[model samples]
Target: MRPNIVVIQADQMAAQALGAYGDPAARTPHIDALAADAAVYDRAYCNTPLCAPSRASMMTGRMPSDIGCYDNGDDFAASTPTFAHHLRAAGYHTALVGRMHFIGPDQHHGFEQRLTTDVYPADMDMVPDWRRELDDRLQWYHDADAVYTAGASQATVQQDFDDEVSFRTLRHLNDRVRANQAAGERIPFLMVTSFIHPHDPYEPPQEHWDRFEDVHIPDPAHPEVPDPAQDPHSHRLRAMSGFDQRETTDEEVRRARRSYYAAVSYIDDQIGRIRERLETLGLAEDTVIIVTSDHGDMLGEKGLWFKMSPYEESSRVPMIIRGPEHLVPQGRYENPVSLLDLMPTLLELAGTDPEVASTGSPEEEIAPARRGLSLLESARRERSGRSGPEDRDVTIEYLAEGTLRPQLTLVRGQYKLVVCPGDPDQLFDLVADPSELRSVADAPEHAEVTASMRAQLEAQYDLRGLEAEILTSQARRRLVAEALQRGTVRHWDHEPDPEQRYVRGDFWGALQHGQIRIPQGGAEGAA
Candidate 1:
């Protein structure tokens, strides 16, 4: 019989924020305990930093750009292959308890069922008739309320909203066990329990926040950020809504960090509850429990509030796997890995046939163009002392509006290069400067290193068949218009009123028709 799979994923969680990862202030005893039995991957990274794209990539085991899910509002194509589909084909009972962020028609994918949760549908960007009646000012206020109210501080809100997601998941597990007993057959389950805490408005329950309030928080090593003139991305960040140019004092930074830690702890507690239930049901030993996150939060690193950059803080995440002792050894893996590798690894563990794995391929016999290898195989090869195949260097590309091209890519070895279309390139030696405080791109002594990394990046772009041209204003208008027409709009602040708000499609039409012109070039494209 195959082992059951349980994936407990947190949103916007950074590995370093956990005590297991060496943060003295973190209250992640549950995850820490689980890590004791699991193989802890120390260098796992998200393919993209934003939620939609990152989730899409992990679901399909494909890069965001490769699949065209380049930003938060972009929808995953319905025909895209996903792990859930493959697992269903292999005869496992599949289900998602929360937070798939599918943004398309096939919300369930191949999952036999969705227990129940608030899923931001694919049409969320479009303006509904009820919302269209409201005026713009009223709509903006409504949106603000919706977001601020949903931010991470209130215990009532957290338990009422996210905790239910956990409860439903646990109930599903219990039902499965009961059904198996009744049928006199052993069955495996693939369940994903996703939570939306630790991601935003920086709020945590009062008690959790108090636990870390006294803990000392370290200010960024280089608080003196680069001049905005030189770093346009930094400048644009300051200009964004909710981001102010005022100096971030040590006290405020510490306070924010404390809240973030509290949020993580809260999520950790929920995970602990789920694990306890699993063990009580006698399925712990036979189950493969994978804990990870879609991406990492910056927490004010580099004067940035959220993800989208190629910095370590924004790109790196945590991946822990615990199950049958023989499958995953307990230790940390220093080698780099990508979340895109999870699908193939899961398929391998589930004993999925090669034909099921090839479902999404144009030629069923040919394997998909996967850039990742199975983590289980990699671990096995390493344990045998045989020199495994050379690790493929990973790369990330960001193509936000106003940028000349999707020009940021990080080669896994030790060098990172940031290309700004129509501007000088920035290069950093991550081995020496992990914080990326200095750019050695122009240093005469490091010319050879810079040249080598640039060549690798260019070669990767060529191999991927990427077009490096910046989007023309007209083109941008057309794409935005298309998104608006196809997407639904939900106000975060006020009640839904169609008369007061512009529908996504109508908004896009206005922009395309020259009614609105968004400012570009400065910090507009910063992550």
Candidate 2:
């Protein structure tokens, strides 16, 4: 029997904010506990540092560039197959329970069922205009509101949506267990129980807020903020988000940090509940669990509060995997990995050959076109107390709402290279200077290292070509958005199963029987 797969995806969660990732200020006990038993990737990242692009990359096991998912409004082209497509072809019951941020009409890539609609606008709302005036902030840009009014709230739209996500997912698990028992069969399932939290609005439950008031939250590494000339991309992002226009106090920053911490804790608690339910059903050992985030938030790092930047805080994310002990390994793997690796890894765990059925291909055309390597064998080696694989270069990209150009990154063991078309190249020796205080690109001593990294970046991406393509795509999307908003709009948001059936309401009080027609099994409503 194949192991059941459960992926707990959190939104806008940074590695630096997690207790498992060495932030003492965090109260993520459930995440830490999962980290203890799993093989953790210390230097994991998102292929593209945004919600829709990263998720589309994750589902397809291909880079965002390969699929042309450069921004949130970009469609996950219909022909594009996802992980669910591969798993379902192999007879697994696949389902999505929460936010995947899929744009366009075909919401379910291959999942047989979707429990709820996406929380954010699923249309062209995320598209950016390349022609907009410089320094002109969008109406929806991240502002000082979250930081100034940061505090505990009993409930938020985010909390309410996630509550339904959890309740429905747990209910699905229970129903599946009972059905399988009745049929005396072992039907495998793949469930993605995703959550949207720790993202923004910097509000969590009051209980979680009180849990972190006394705890010390460290100031950002570059708390003084960088000069516009020194770090052009950071400066551009700050301006784009309207952060440069307002002055936020230290107290506000602290409160914002506290609220973010509490939000993470809230996510931890939800994950714990899901895990416990699986264990209660005796499905824990039979399931392979993977936890990750779409992308990381800056959270005021370098005076930036959101993603869409190449900085570590905005790009690096957490990737933790746990499964049957005998079937898998444990301990941290230092070799760099990203969400791109998840699709192949999931296929491998389900007793399928990743090389055979690449996530984006149909079963008959089982060719290996994956850009990421599976870590199953290496993770097993680590569990048996053997040395892991050598450090390798991991690539990250950013081309979204923030700036006029694209930012591509290449991260090796200790070196991080940022390749932006307009700005000067940046090279950081993370071992010597973790905060990236100064660039070593101009240093004579590390000239060879810089050359090699730049060559690697050039080989991996055509920066000039991508920039042109991104600009063209943006213009077309903007025109389409304008035309669609003229009169009646056709939205792509998923409409979940409706509530409040008419027959169930006040039938006894009215004493009037209104004849209602029923839809037949194979046809429309019968009169």
Q: How badly does each model clash, as a count of residue pairs?
A: 37, 0
lDDT over C-alpha atoms for residue 184 of model 1: 62
The local lDDT score (0 to 100) that residue 93 gets in candidate 2 is: 88
Candidate 1 residue lDDT tens string, 468-526: 32233224534654565665744321111122223456686534333222236432311
For each candidate, C-alpha RMSD in Å? 13.7, 7.2
> What TM value does model 1 have?
0.80
- Deviation in Å, model 1, residue 495 alpha carbon: 19
Q: Write the per-residue lDDT of candidate 2 for residues 54-161, one digit (tens) a residue.
A: 999899888787788888888888678788988998888898999999987789988988989999877877787667864776676666687788889988999899
Error of 1 at 249 (Å): 3.8
The models' CA-based lDDT, in order, is: 0.66, 0.81
Model 2 RMSD vs true structure? 7.2
